[model samples]
Target: RKDIAVIPYEPRYQSAFKALNEEWITAHWEMEEPDHKALDHPQEYILDKGGHIFIALYRDEPVGVCALCKKDDPEHEYELAKLAVSPGVQGKGIGVLLCRTVISKAKELGCKKIFLESNTLLRPAIRLYRKLGFKEIPKSHPAYERVDIQMELVID
Candidate 1:
């Protein structure tokens, strides 16, 4: 992970972000409407809405991505979504780096909490979330049907 650095999304890495996320989403389940909306227009869907997307670069090569999307809720909650690491370098702590960086970014932006939705089939991701201090919460109106579990980390 020495050479890997997580940085904010840039126009140059737009396609890479979409590709990385599409690979994983399609691998597990078909892309949903929400996926299309976010992936197709990250700037408008995320950044323009007061959200943040961070990209992981290894020696200048795009390899991972994570987004903290501002939610429509009353309380200042952000949705941690679209986290994907390249398959070629899965266990190099890239995903952990992205998660930790995004969480820190959320706190700096005065976020009260960060929430995420994931399916039970993605146990590794769930474990990572828990390790990052996110606790499971009762499901509400999930964006996708694949989301069977919802978690949130209070930015204390």
Candidate 2:
């Protein structure tokens, strides 16, 4: 975690975000319409809509990316989406840094909860979510067909 930092999304990091996410999406499942929208237009589809995206940089190079997408839930929930760390550095705890950043940002924004929809194939990601205190919830209609499990973390 040395020299690694999580920073707010910037237009300059657009390509890095897209590349990082696309690598994982294509590896696990075909890129869906929702994935295309979010990855291609993070500024408009996410940030402009009151959501936030964070990028993890190791020694100033973008290595991972995550997003907190605002949702319509009246309880003020944010969907934690598009988390991906480069394959070369998978076990290096970059994802943890990103998740911690999201939690801090969500609480700072006064969000009541954070949720995510993911597929079972990503066992590592699921485990990370569980370790971060996200409990599994009944699966709901999600944007992507790949999502078989939904999890949420309530912010107190």
Candidate 3:
């Protein structure tokens, strides 16, 4: 309870979101193509589409962010995207808290399943996903050509 808070995205968090993306790219996606515009646009879209976006705060300072995107598929699924914790605070429990928050938010949204894509380079994150009850699934997303692993969780 040490002043960790998760709140919806706001315009004021653009800088923090950018910082998080930079950290994530540097740490886990060094070989992948960097599409700055694509990265920047999703935060705006998530905020505008009534999607759930959460930022973790430590004593009022932004330290992490996560978002849930409603899938267009008729299966009533969701996508968990952009879950990032500050590089400076990586080992703490903030990432776990952020994930739990997203799962709860997904359940609240009536999502029966949730999916995410990750590269194999992110060993820590992959382990975290497994620990959180996510299971590896066959890759089916067309937009994620570089993803080495796909995971899904049944929320219902």
Model 1, global lDDT: 0.92
All candidates' lDDT scores? 0.92, 0.91, 0.77
Expressed as tens digits, the lDDT of each residue in 5-114 for candidate 1 is: 99999989889999999999999899999999999999899999999999999998999999999999875379899999999989899999999999999999988889
Best by lDDT: 1
Clashes of 3: 0
Per-candidate count of clashing residue pairs (backbone under 3 Å): 0, 0, 0
For model 2 the local lDDT of residue 80 reads: 89
Residue 119, model 1, lDDT? 91
Q: Model 2 off-target regions past 4 Å?
A: none
TM-score-wise, the better of 2 and 3 is 2
Consecutive 10-residue window with the lowest summed lDDT within model 1: 70-79
RMSD for each of the candidates: 0.9, 1.0, 2.4
Candidates sorted on lDDT, descending: 1, 2, 3
